[model samples]
Target: MRGPDPWAAPPPPAPGGATGLGGAGSGPGAGRPVSWGREILAGAVVMAAVAAAVGPVLGLLWERLAPRVRLLVGGDALYLENPESQQAIAGDGTFLLLGLGVGLAAGVGVFLLRRRSGVAETAGLALGAGLGAVLAWRLGELLEPDRDEIRELARRLGDGAVIDAPLELNALGALIGPAFGALLAHFLCMALWGPRDPVRRPPVFPRWG
Candidate 1:
């Protein structure tokens, strides 16, 4: 005769049950993430991209606003050179504004994408600022390689002459613009949207006699 049914109903789902097929959520993030390094790197890249794109525009703005004389007088050519004083003022103002604007935009973008601010956002803001500053510095260097020539021209030409295409980068802009911009963006985001929730701490109890 056949033995009794030892198999009963279904077997229990072992220990931790069945794992997912693929390595979903295998990488850095999701509820207490650990992708700080990666996020920082990505932020740097983003800043670099923004700087590169904006550099050309900054140069263009400087050129447009740079003061110039329409006509060359009898001896004006003797001291004709690019606009120095005006260029300095205009370029500095423009750089600061643009840097701040870019940072603010970046902050908005990050805020929209993420549910809350965290290490990634903070890192991105700080590192991105540094990168932007470096880029602004480089833009001036790369775009204006004939500084000596311009200086020489200025020395030879007479006063009142003008250089139609003058270009320069204000040192202060590269130094302070990015940092200020990043700070502003961070402040705005935090003030308006608030930062991510911090890790909760355990409650402490008092000792009893």
Candidate 2:
């Protein structure tokens, strides 16, 4: 025999023997129970990263579209009140939508990757949204209003006139964005991938045992 005929099909794997692919351990789906902690951590980290990246840009846009007062200061320059408040309101509203979109995408991804929805993933989505919103709000806090305009309004109105819109996160937005995002994501996941699998416990008594 020429070295067992090179390139010839090897002997068929013995029944129940290691199939040269996997026997007791080794395969794509082979793994321990899913690590919920890891999943939550990963999701939170990703959401935070995205929020951090967008916070400054959102803050700038919000500031530009900031609300204004209807009256004039001393009959001269426009006297705007609560630029901070206006900016926060606008930012919060705008970013809430953004956060929702992100959540939807995330939820869809989780459903597809896992081939089903589960409580762990639902929690993960909520956790991620919360963390992301917090991070974005924190970053947006760095924005400032037009100091020149503030000083001018103050000088003309003899102090305590113009309401300065301080730089900060929109409180309502921060609170609602994460909640809405997580819920939306959960809904999307359920709509797309169906509900989670019900747990199967061992037979009550003895079946064939």
Candidate 3:
């Protein structure tokens, strides 16, 4: 018998375009295409936009509703005045823009840290919003109209001796507004553009394995 043909023609290609290197269609070289970085950037941008738009809307609504409820429940005696002169600060278009800028910055930061997907983004946004709200609240308290003025106003409305408590409520409002703004923005982005998954990837090579 002739020596086994050392170089017999390679077996015919498999039907349906299969390759022998890794068994059936497409060898180990084949891989799913991906654009992880781009997707992350896009996700961040969308999240930021969501945060900015929703924040102001929620803030204004809250302001309006809170006062109304206070008036209704407290009757004539219960009153909360919003002494802030800048309506924008109270959830106007300018504040919305500010919120947007802040949100974008947060998103960019998150993206840079490689926390740009799934629940990571959500968590990042939430953390950022909380911090931002706290900062805003403190700043508002610092810049608030003099406590004496509030005391005078309370005195003018008096049913009794006016107790001039430190403006704790004012500070609270300031803090709450930014927090709400951030939350709303985050929610909107998640609803409209957040990643489908919230879980992160497992590391390659199982620790047990």
Q: Report the lDDT tens digits of candidate 2 across residue range 29-139.
A: 334567778776666654554444344444444445444333324444545553444453565666666655555555555556655445655655566566656655555
Best by TM-score: 1
Clashing pairs in 1: 78-156, 78-157, 78-158, 79-157, 79-158
Ranking by lDDT: 1, 2, 3
lDDT (CA) for every model shown?
0.53, 0.53, 0.45
lDDT of 1 at 102: 57
Question: In model 1, where is the ten-residue run with the lowest total lDDT?
Answer: 18-27
| TM-score per model over all chains | 0.52, 0.47, 0.32
| Candidate 3 minimal-lDDT segment of 10 residues | 66-75
Instruction: State candidate 3's TM-score.
Output: 0.32
**Residue pairs with backbone atoms closer than 3 Å in model 2 (clashes):** 83-165, 84-165
What CA root-mean-square deviation does each model show from the true structure? 11.0, 11.2, 13.1
lDDT score of residue 20 within candidate 1: 27
Highest lDDT model number? 1
Tell me the deviation in Å of residue 101 in model 3. Answer: 23
Candidate 3 stretches greater than 4 Å from native: 1-30, 67-146, 155-209
lDDT tens digits, residue span 78-195, model 3:
3333334333233434333454455555544444444335553555466546555444433434544465665556556665432322322332334334445445655655566544
Candidate order by TM-score, decreasing, is: 1, 2, 3
